[model samples]
Target: MKDTKILKIHNKSDKPDNIVIRDNNLIEECIIIEKSLPNFMKDYFVYLKGSVSVSTRHAYLKDIKFFCNYLVESQELTIAKEICDITLEEFNLIKARDVNLFLGDYCTRYYKHTSQDTTLIYENNNRALARKKSSLSTLFKFMFRNEQLDSNITDGFNPIKLPKPQPDAIKRLDIDEVAKMLDSVENGYGLTDKEKVYWRKTKLRDKAILALFVTYGLRLNELRELNISSFNFSRGEFKIYRKRGKEVLMPINHTCEVVVKDYIYNERTKSELLAEEHKDALFLSLQNKRITPKAIRQLVKKYTSISMETSRDSGYSPHKLRATAATSLIQNGFSIYDVQNLLDHDNVTTTQLYAAHKKHVKRDIVNNFEWIDDKKETSLD
Candidate 1:
């Protein structure tokens, strides 16, 4: 006898009737998982789909899968062998202690597939554990609010307290370092003869990229997503899509405007690598496609490293460029509120961190102490 295949069908109303079938095995696996989920859990994910980004939803799914695996491996719950096998009643039966074990111990020893090979190995880190805890916490809160679970067991689990990140006092470039970086990119300084030749080809584009980072404090994604239409030459402004789906208009400084225009007209337009579809892109790779975030980071690192004296000074990424912009603005007497607006920070507190790191603040404090000491010494003399 032939085995019956379980097929998962999407609600026809939710999608177009003319569906092109592709990747049969992947479709089958998705169908199996969909069929396996309890109705309540399915509803929970459906509710989340309306609110969260695709990447965020993907994390939630992974975290929930890990929780289900814990039930089977640690608790020896036969019903939890498959995620769909776990019932709404079983979820309610989960105590605070069960959740604590999952968040603390299970997360610490979970297997991760290595990038170079298929071998799975245990990896434990505070960041990964904290993310899982947060994911589970979000899930439990959703379940409790929707009455899928009798109580929120995750509420009883203590927060994962990771150590504070060390301040990047040494990592941030001073004003002279920033000037040197821009000068090197423009003049091909510290570059080999071969590199200097390549730098001439990409100088305008590279300068525009660096200028945008220093001037606007754009996140990597925000910069990568830029199109030619994103800039308004007449209005002297540009639009950027920020985190959480925000679109904001930002003013372009005179330096950024000139460099970007020069690249667009002189270098970018002359490139034979530009593809038809990517013509709208503000930046293109050698392949003539929209430049990726990874490529942008590499470019930033390349120029930053050339400006540094040692490897210790060479770890600056695009984010550090963002920090540089914010700190520079704060040091030049821009209000924290203005810096927050420019950085597109939702909260003022985030901008305050940059303000706290202002080099001028430290300098002024030291100078005041010196003045006090000088007064005492003069009085004694």
Candidate 2:
């Protein structure tokens, strides 16, 4: 782990004690990739490490690897055998047409991965292709900015146009379904005898997790990163770290507050199951450690499948709970701007997409229209 001392203090509360500045695992992963790639690419990763999030850097590395594979297969470039051998002159030979071909071909072909003599073939969708193209564009821009390349070949190529948003694309549960899901969690309606026995032990924690998701529209990572100190009982609020490292405080409702408090004080404190390292974490797995995002997702799927009939069609996940929370707020007469703030969206356009999904607004508008009197009115023929 790397440590940098704080030279300037803007606010005392802003800098928490023992705060992790960078993920050590991510730094180690970047170092491994740096040793494998060419010097220029290594430098590019170093530049990106300072500016972007760990997740973004990880994705860029994967995309660049895909680009290298494309160069080997399509262009018959020997440098692909060892990425470190690729010269600047070879990089400059890549044109906009080559990039176009890469994007087009990626969508149609299968990317094969082999490990332990087992092969897996993955197909790229339009969105995946667009993301790969964006990653390549960022790499080219970096090369041009640093004078490593004479010009950016990716600049002339047109980007892939995404399809317009559809109403059905946003899958969310109705208010009644949300109520049923909560009830099922509390009552253990459809669970097996063995599952019910397990639920009896962790019901409070499970309820708290579900309440937080439906009430605040928390993303999986946001929920997972929560600590016991994050909640302010006096203020009736809790703090969360959002994407891009932005921290925001959100008010807790009566129901969420009750469940979370019950889990923390009644169940969590009494249990001696927690690992010492995860003592400060708000939610814990059966293994007595901080819960993973995958576990939280599976929890949501398990409960929703038992509680809602439309779970098969709508698909229940943590994100779907977020959408349900947004839709419920809109249905309850909150403004789109309010929903945007609650959900922590960077743009109002994303909130507007939820507004488009509100079928009641369209129904009310159509219901208010007066029909012409067929007996009294005549055509102006």
Candidate 3:
């Protein structure tokens, strides 16, 4: 079966959320043709007709483009003249064998390069390459449907088995390391007395952001989209409008709640925030506009750099904070099922990446499973 993730349009109906999968038997597989080609291609049309959000569409575009660049460079196919040069017929011809060969060769040639340097795979994985791949994939699919062929060549072809370079294992901060990092933030690159005061207030907001992500596993986008009114204090739940524009209420623990309360009551109020007519953005920059993703990233990087210096190897990224929260929750005896629900992952497998074996903790706790002799039998008398 083709393992596909379907996008659902958010409907604010009273009915409960339902997902509709559209792979394999979902559609009566057939091949058709048209006089004229599609604007993009067949694969892309499927995605567009489905409920994919803008960001998701953009990401798919990027991934496809990266693949396209590889095709162009490796095959020596000059497709820049007209986008149509990469037709469905052409795409199907490029098989899994080709993809596997390309990935193996690419990784072998250029794997360990640092961020400062450029390599073939690195260069092809940029935003532009993503768009190219997206457009190209759709074109291929369109041709399979419309272009006259013996059969559905696209379907006959095997799925690409690209190399997924294993990411660094999940690294989380202990309570002491988290505290030390927070303490060190007051001393950053350059701070005058005025800057120090400014940093103090900013630090509170930064700490709150990190604390929430670490404690709650909120995504960077989810946290950025939050408003002062997003939280219901009485219920201890914050409403998050997720990527697909679905509303989800995230329950918070006391620590995260405290940090949020402190940020709003003490720091955010004093930032001289100015909102545009439609701008109900929760997080604001010093200039008072809604904080951009880049700004948030920079803020995370700065704190992460400071945190790394204090001995935590993974540093303080928003994502690292999210991973930390997931790992920590699992280590504290939370089930993978509970973690999946809390993290709001659509798939259990996404949650399982963090749902790992607790080998280190088990070694320490295994002995304690047997009751102490003094405590075991005294109640019998």
Candidate 4:
């Protein structure tokens, strides 16, 4: 008797998709569908099941989306429609020249300043331009694997090199200027409603924030994340959580201890706070959530803007307060190691940036000068 063939169906057409014929008694044939493979391969990274954080996954997804958009906009490549049909020759045709041209044009178009002058060069000569190039380079590399483009296009693509701008020379607040600012804060003279609100609720907050930065050199993030529980008011010591989740504690002398205590007991007690959250959060916003990093940045910017209007000499930011702290500590003879640990720096080199203040260098130069001795001894020797 003749055996019938069996077919595996790939489509819903009248003909069988896969064919099987009798071998001894049975026969078989295989049918392959080429269409769905590209879509499956595009998301291959999602199947790995290895432990990675949500943020990392989000970043990867964002990078892939960026690449897909770039391909469509820059090269007329589409992941769903045109990607599978792309040949190796067609893939390689998407060149570094294209990427560079796209980036250069994109940077030039979006980076303009609004001073009514088209000829004015945008601030493209800095770190932002470099980062835009980096983002493009990274996205291209990701596309080559997932979207099946040539990964080599991104290879050897030189990143834009940007020279670091020299740090604005440290503008230290003089004692008299500090006194004047403090007087303005205390008396609330000639200040706006916003400034008055800042002056009232933020006296202790500002004092504590500034004192901590100027006294111990806290970063903006560190001050924002400070917890009341971390402070030992009796012992005058407070712990600060630094970047990348490290902690350091430094002692406050009696003067700062009084200020902090006064702030906590008198001013901070009135804040509306969130229940079921950490009550120990050292700084609270008006809405009573733990003070956020953005708030800290804004506070610094606002106060500094006000101070700048009063005295350019007091044009201070949180970073300047940090610098002020470093200079003050180094002026009072704090060891570099002490400053490094207090600031929770991973390397001594970063600490050295703060260490090389003009004041300390000048003081050392004057103290080491032998001009008086030379004049007294005369020329005979």
Model 3 Cα displacement at 362 (Å)?
1.4
Model 1 stretches with alpha carbons more than 4 Å out: 1-39, 70-75, 78-80, 112-124, 165-170, 269-274, 359-381
Model 1 residue 299 CA deviation (Å) reads 1.0
lDDT of 4 by residue, 299-371 (tens): 5555554545654234567787676666667656888788887767678776666667745677789999866
| Model 4 local distance difference test score | 0.57
Pick out the ten consecutive residues of candidate 4 with the lowest summed lDDT: 16-25
TM-score of each: 0.81, 0.86, 0.65, 0.62
RMSD of each: 6.6, 4.8, 10.5, 16.3
The candidate that wins on TM-score is: 2
- Clash pairs, candidate 1, are 36-84
Off by more than 4 A, model 4: 1-68, 77-99, 111-125, 132-155, 165-183, 186-194, 234-236, 270-274, 292-295, 305-315, 346-349, 359-381
Model 3 C-alpha lDDT per residue in residues 54-91, reported as the tens digit of each score: 44554444445555655665555445433434564565
**For candidate 1, lDDT tens digit of each residue in 1-381?**
998875444544421111111123344444454455556677777775677754466666667776776776664544666666777777788887877777677667767557767767676688888888887888788989888788878768877788665445525666778899899888988777887787887888899999899888899878877788789999999887776556688988899999999999988854445655566778877667777788888778888887775452365899988988888899888999999989988888778777776665778788777634445434454
TM-score ranking from best to worst? 2, 1, 3, 4
Question: How much lDDT does each candidate structure score?
Answer: 0.75, 0.78, 0.58, 0.57
Any runs in candidate 2 off by more than 4 Å, and if so which?
1-22, 73-75, 111-118, 269-273, 310-315, 365-381
Question: How well does candidate 1 match the true structure in TM-score terms?
Answer: 0.81
Candidate 2: clashing pairs of residues: none
Q: Compare candidates 1 and 4 on TM-score and give the better one.
A: 1
Each model's number of backbone clashes? 1, 0, 15, 11
